[model samples]
Target: MVRQFVSSGSTFETQMGYSRAVVAGDWVFVSGTTGFDYSTMTISDDIGEQTRQAFANIAAALEQAGSRLDEVVRVTYVLPDGGLFEQCWPAMRDAFASARPAAMMIEAGLASPEMKIEIEVTALKGSAA
Candidate 1:
């Protein structure tokens, strides 16, 4: 099987020596994605907007890997502030409620102060990988 590398042009991706996602066979492993609009390189101050953008970014990565949000089997979320759970959950539930992928939430600081939330997902497509 050939290993595929994916990048979203996020500075950390190159600097840290990792792709935004990797595809091998039928599995797509997405890296921890922060809530920033790569097109504009901006993060919204509002947690809701940031949460939504983070999922959007994850979805884009999945698309790049020949998968979609509905194919995601697992997800993990990291937050700089645990208190923001209320702010994050609604958006998350809204995004994944239909797909209902197994998910976990944890508290941790991101690389930058401006980053409040980061999300990662694992998707399975086909039955090869």
Candidate 2:
């Protein structure tokens, strides 16, 4: 078996001593991904938009690791405020509506003040990338 690191154009991972995602054999373990738009380096104040971006970020990382969102086996969400919990589900459902991976949502402050949602996912591939 071998190990590989996956990153999707964000500075935080290196600064935080973490990779965006890691692939070991047939498994890809993605780190908690925030809602920043990597292309613009911007995060929205809206929780719904934040949740959408988080999934987009996670999806990008999974693709880089030679996997897809549909391949995700599990997901964990970190929310700064439970108040916004209701607002996040629609976006979550749309992103993973077909996949429906086992998931959990918990309260936690994200890395930045503007970040309202963060997501981490695990995906399995049939073979190494």
Candidate 3:
């Protein structure tokens, strides 16, 4: 099977030796993506806005891998404060209301204090149909 690696131009990817996502056959595995806007390298303080930005980053990676949010089959969310998870529900629902993939959430410390949330996803290419 041919495997392809997708990059989001984030310096961390290079420094950490990882791709934004990897496509293996019909599967796309997106790395844990944060809310920092790749273009500006800035992140929002609000959890809701951070959540939306994280989803946007994930969507971009999935799109680059020949997949989409609707094709996602599994998702994992990490937040420094579990209580803030509720604040992300609206954005999460908006992004995955269609696919409604199996999901999990974990409370954990992020690399930086400014990083409120990180999301990772797995998608099966063309699975949405």
Which candidate number would show the highest lDDT if scored against the true structure?
Answer: 3
- Over the full model, what C-alpha lDDT does candidate 1 score relative to the true structure? 0.86
Q: TM-score for every candidate vs. truth?
A: 0.91, 0.92, 0.97
Candidate number with the higher lDDT (2 or 3) = 3
Per-residue C-alpha lDDT of model 2 across residues 37-95, encoded as one tens digit per residue:
88887888898998888888888898899898888889998888978899998998888
Per-residue lDDT of 78-125 in model 3, one digit per residue for the tens? 999999899999999999989999999999999999999999999998
Q: Model 3 TM-score? A: 0.97
User: Where is model 1 more than 4 Å wrong at Cα?
Assistant: 126-129
Candidate 1 per-residue lDDT, tens place, 53-107, comes to 9989988988888988878889898888989878887888887766788889999
| lDDT, model 2, position 103 | 92
Candidate ordering by TM-score (highest first): 3, 2, 1
Candidate whose TM-score is highest: 3
- The C-alpha stretches of model 3 lying farther than 4 A from their native spots are none
Task: Note the Cα lDDT for every prediction shown.
Answer: 0.86, 0.86, 0.94
Candidate 3 local lDDT, residue 66: 85
